[model samples]
Target: MVQAALQYERQRRGLGGVFLDEIARIERHVSDAPGLYQLVEAPIRRATLRRFPFGLFYLEELDRIVVLACLDLRRDPQMIGVTVARR
Candidate 1:
């Protein structure tokens, strides 16, 4: 996510901040309603960012949610599956 922010910053002056803000907004939604998202894998759920091509992968647990990854949507599905699996 930091890398993506840095890349966005390179593209424009405050674009990185905008990207981070979007991430925060999406995170808040996930925190407020973890079960609102679809289950991509067996257990892992994905919350996609509104303005960016990134998806936040998390596991909804009994007491809390566990964020596994914030990955670029452009990445290969197989690689994403592997990375999420490892986490």
Candidate 2:
């Protein structure tokens, strides 16, 4: 996520701020109630960014939520699965 924001910063003056705002929006949604998000797979839920082409993947546990990945939507889904599987 930081890498994408840095790239946006390099490309434009204030675009990175836009990304941050979207991230904050997503964060608020999660922090308010993690279980509010829709499930993506069997055990994972996904929260999408409002403006940017990114999504946050997470898993809710008994006591805490685990953030699995912050993915740039431009990447292939299969590649993303491979990347996430290793972790």
Candidate 3:
């Protein structure tokens, strides 16, 4: 998110704010209902931002929620799968 925000800020002054706002909004949703969104796969869950092409990947633990990645959906699914597998 830091890198994406930096790039977004360079392109346009306030886009970073928009990007972060979307993330916060999603955070609120997650906080309210941790199991609201269905799991995309075992151990990981996904929720799409309202107007962005990006989506968040996360893991819900007993004590806390761990965000895995902010994915750019424009990328190829196969590439994304491989990239995430490495992590």
Candidate 4:
């Protein structure tokens, strides 16, 4: 099992609070069902919540999962990467 960590700035965004809630939900799911998460590439992977327009991006490390950012589908994913790196 992999431990999970959320970036600080990403936690602050809240994105009207829904983002944080969704992230927590994802973390719980990941904790219970790590195998269900799909790889997007090195340093990044995504998991979607049913009926939500958002996706969670995370880094799968050997000991833990680093949640880089939670993104709304309408936003630019590239920019989100830059933001996560900056944080």
What RMSD, rounded to one decimal, does every model reach?
A: 0.7, 1.5, 1.6, 7.6
What is the TM-score of candidate 2? 0.84
Best by TM-score: 1
Query: lDDT for every model?
Result: 0.94, 0.81, 0.80, 0.64
Task: Kindly list the per-residue Cα lDDT of model 4 for residues 1-87, writing each as its tens digit.
Answer: 111223433545534355456667888887666557877655577788653566777777677777776666667867766765675
Indicate the worst ten consecutive residues by lDDT in candidate 4: 1-10
Q: State, as a TM-score between 0 and 1, how close model 3 is to the true structure.
A: 0.83
Give candidate 1's whole-model lDDT: 0.94
State residue 69's C-alpha deviation in candidate 2, in Å.
1.2
Please identify model 2 stretches exceeding 4 Å from their true place: none
Quote the lDDT for 38 in model 2: 69
TM-score of each: 0.96, 0.84, 0.83, 0.57
Best by lDDT: 1
For residues 1-87, write the lDDT of model 3, one tens digit per residue: 777777788989998888889989998898777788768777878778886787787778998888878888788977766665566
Error of 3 at 79 (Å): 2.1
RMSD in angstroms, candidate 1?
0.7
Write one digit per residue (lDDT tens) for candidate 1, span 1-87.
899999999999999999999989988999999999989987899999988999999999898889999999899989999999998
Instruction: Score candidate 1 by TM-score against the native.
Output: 0.96
Candidate 1 vs candidate 3: the TM-score winner is 1
In model 2, how large is the Cα lDDT of residue 58?
82
